[model samples]
Target chain A: MAREASVSEVLLDARGIAKSFGGVQALRDVSLTIGRGEIYGLIGPNGAGKTTFFNVLTGLYSADSGEVQFDGARLDIGLPHLVTRQGIARTFQNIRLFANMSALENVMVGRHLRSHASVIGAVLRNRATRREEADIVDRAHRLLRYVGVDARANDLARHLSYGDQRRLEIARALATEPKLLALDEPAAGMNATETASLRQLVESIRADGVTVLLIEHDVKLVMGLCDRVAVLDYGEKIAEDVPDRVQRDPKVVEAYLGGALA
Target chain B: MTTLEGKRRDPRVALAGTLLLAVALALAPFAVGAGAGIAWVRVIDFALLYIMLALGLNIVVGFAGLLDLGYIAFYAVGAYLYALLSSPHLAGAFPSLAPGLHWPIWAILPLGALVAGAFGVILGAPTLRLRGDYLAIVTLGFGEIIRIFMNNLNRPVNLTNGPQGITQIDPIGIGGVSFGRTLDVFGIGLPSVYLYYYLFLGATLLVVFVSIRLEDSRIGRAWVAIREDEIAAKACGINTRNIKLLAFAMGASFGGVAGGLFAGFQQFVSPESFTLMESVMVLCMVVLGGMGHIPGVIFGGILLTLLPEALRYGAGPVQTALFGKVLVPPESLRMLLFGLALILVMLYRPAGLWPSAIRRREFAGAGNSPENGAGSERE
Candidate 1:
């Protein structure tokens, strides 16, 4: 299901990525390639190292061994902010919005890397800073509208419904204008209607030419919406292929429902 | 659409309301009797100074979520900077630089702020990784270190004049107009306290303006974002280290300016002035008023500063009325009442007397509201 253009040009490529915490090997030799404009899915049972792999890819946890290449350059996974500046943005499994800030301000905070206003500029409120601030507010509003949360733009993120908070988090991530956007369990605790809208939102996001790599628990959602799906079980990739083939793989089935199925 | 519309107010109305409040505050000194007016002005002057300190601390604790318990160190640095530059002690210590050139308050103000800011960055750089209680402990230690240095630094160099402190500090004056003396303006002789009041008011207004501008800017948003969630803020491309340091430096600069003013008004500087209790009092103002809210902090500063003084005045009369004879001295009763008031405020209004709207909503604990559920579905 990968598009022809995406197939030829990979956006994110991880090779032999591994991480360990003390004696526990959280991630082991996980490798994957996400092409430009493709919606890649990562799925695994609880404690299967899916999140650990995401953390390594996003530079939250330093990989013990491996290299991650984004847009054909060796990604220097330094600080999380530096990784974001390199054009990869991510959301958390547990939504981490700036709860005290308004929805618009939350998105504007996402524009921090792109904006050039300094403390002096802010204190002085110069013409350039004012103009840039206006642009930020306008862009923030547009992003809120894009995520269908514009009506709640003035509302505090914490005051928003759980589903709206998820959407707002996505909007904030999009405000970074990333080449690759990663979502971690975006559909968790969402109703069927909310999940359907989320799927559509992801499709629209991909249509905007932003590549997406998502970790989801809903196998049906992944199978239906993803261009390719990768299955992880016990810190290793058990299957990586087009969603239909990956879903039918014996290892994937066994990982989901015990060894008796295998 | 209805909710958004409901939240909107006419800009003109808000402007008018603010202008009216400013006018009332400006005229308040003149409205009182002469002696009471002087006393009121003195109270207001200290209140303004405390407001500046609280605003500065707000940047660190309220905006960046850095619990700083030793913020008075910066205040002490500013005061001592002013003291050293504009006092005879400098000449007394170094005879070569004798007839020590006393700098004008205007000149010393920025220098004090800059020196305090430098110290702030110096203190902040090492403790960037420490959060919450650990950060508080480091800052508390930093404050005590500055105080101890001020107390004992008279031996070799006589920098701070030991426990004797630096005195004979020059009062601030511009040309013929001196803030320390009564000035005849249009047939009426204005008290020096009135002049000090106006000076302090102007300084307060400037700090308030700067604080409001910073609160609404990208930097302010970054600080608040860091405060709310540092990990998420960093992932969103905010350099948390630099931002947190900036918060400290900016906050310290304000404390420095306030310290300079304290030196000028009192014409004295002592290590005893900048104690741990002083730092705690300023933090209480921020917490009791409402953290991160400018108007609330200003109100907190004024209320706390004046409350103890007010209690001191009323204690004797109240004690006489209650017991027919004074059982406790007014000074002791004042502290007792002040402590009781703080305890009550904390117990009843933990968020603050006047909390920021976000804080109010957070403490309201209505996250699972049905209206929000319906609102999300509408989107």
Candidate 2:
């Protein structure tokens, strides 16, 4: 059954985004736009630099040329917190949940964006400080519940099962209240059962009004779930369209099958 | 102790604990043994002071996951500020803030905190940009910088009395009564040492209470988030730079307050007191207790301090009876044993002797399962 997606507005718009490591070109002349409440999947063959594109977008690596504009604001370099405050959040391909922290702590970190105590207030322990701190703890738990981990709220993040950890990572990301949530391989290590759950979770997130950028290797999952598909090959966009169109594009086929996909 | 039960417990437990701690602190100086009642009182006073230092360092190294090797620099600045302004040596040099309004400790302490906080800000400003080993090296360098400046500035005529040190410093005055002077009570004069010891204990408890409360707060959560994963913390809009500086300044000021007390208590202080070794000692307390754990740090500070003194006085009679020697000979083997202990402990208990519950759960959870395994039934 096909569920109707809400109006899709241009949520993220990038133009001529270029990045290099020394003389090695990682991303060059890349341009793409993601719509509000849209699920976009990015796929490419090994060494095609999809991860590099993720890095540049999240401010882990700076782009050498062009601009990244999200919600009408140009992205700046080296200020990840600002990117976050601007309503953009992401998870790592390798799962970078705070391993030593509880699932609750990881989410509280995301909610830290809303706190407003100057350094002085923290030390003074005034009335406002107390109120702000209590609110953070309360909201952090709410976020935990929203992501379906309220029961295991106090459990260490690393201790969670593989699938649950991925869910918690999403919760932690959502704690930031981002307009767009970027998941770098949310289904990377999951089995089929986990992937099915992830598909449902993605739909649920989009239902909540957040646009999602999913980087997935599972072709079936990507084709079935994504509203739009963008394929990259050798640091250049080879195709961007509906899943069926992306699948038939000869350039995408050559990039994936090294000749022509079935 | 109720806080140990987690934040969901009764609020009265916390409030009662605070009141009980306040009462106990106020009574400690009057019931001591061994050293002069005065000296023992000062020892407890310093113990409370060290507790504050440990609690603050816990935030930077304990909560935030940042390794700071030079936390004593802020302490040195607070000590020197009080020493330079309130002492007789300054009277001869330039008597403006010097002889410092004879301001009460209640007044001097906050000013001391601000002065130390500002120093923390200054040090954190340029150095907070560095992370991991680089940050450690930079902090280490800053510690040395403050130490060297203190030492060098003391020479050539002497605003700081050169290495001669400063003296005739006044103790805190409350209302109209000076704490440094003894008081009349029930036909007997209670000593000033008792007064200061209790006051210091109160301050230590205050810092500890605030620190534990703050750890679970938004800022507290942010510090741990940054510690666990920097890129993620910022992605959450944590303002990593500001949080890091908050940790730095908060940690430093506690040590600074300790320094101020040292100046006032000893009534004499010099550049020699705030050395790089001082920084190492404070770090040892935090590490030995458990980084990022408050009670562990306080315990660490007290135990580490009392151990050496115990060895000195404790072994004296035994050594004299056995080898016809005093307890500790010149140059104790403590340094060797200290390093050996750290290595042994790290091998066995990297989570710390008494780590904060969250830290223990985080690190220990790696191998063991919770009583109910990590994954719920999802029912």
Question: What TM-score is obtained for chain B in each of the predicted models?
Answer: 0.92, 0.85
Once fitted onto the true fold, the runs of candidate 2 whose alpha carbons sit more than 4 angstroms away are A1-8, A118-135, A259-262, B1-24, B34-38, B95-104, B155-157, B323-348, B367-379
Which ranges in model 1 have alpha carbons more than 4 Å from their true place? Answer: A1-6, A260-262, B1-19, B33-37, B367-379
Q: What would you estimate as the lDDT of candidate 1?
A: 0.86
Q: Show the colliding residue pairs in model 2.
A: B62-B292, B154-B162
Question: Lowest summed lDDT over 10 consecutive residues: which window, candidate 2 chain A?
Answer: A1-10
Candidate 2 lDDT tens digits, B1-379: 1223356747898899988976765555655633344566666667777788778778888777777888888887878777775666655655554544355566677788888888888878897656668888998998888877777775564666656667778776678777787888788787887777766776787888778767756777778777777766666777778888888878777777878887787778777887778777788888878887778898988877765655555455767899888746623745555667778877787766887776566556546532122122111
Tens-digit per-residue lDDT, B1-379, candidate 1: 1122237789999999999988987777787435475687778778889999999998888787788999999989988888888878788779987876578888888898888899999999999988777889999999999999999999898889998888888887877577888889899888877788789889889999899889888889899888778778877988888998899999999999999989888989899999999999999999899988887898899999999999998899988999999999999989898999999998888788998777777677665431221122100
- For each candidate in turn, the TM-score is 0.93, 0.90
Whole-model lDDT per candidate: 0.86, 0.76
Model 1 TM-score relative to the real fold? 0.93
The fraction of reference A/B contacts recovered in model 2 reads 0.67
Error of 2 at B125 (Å): 2.6
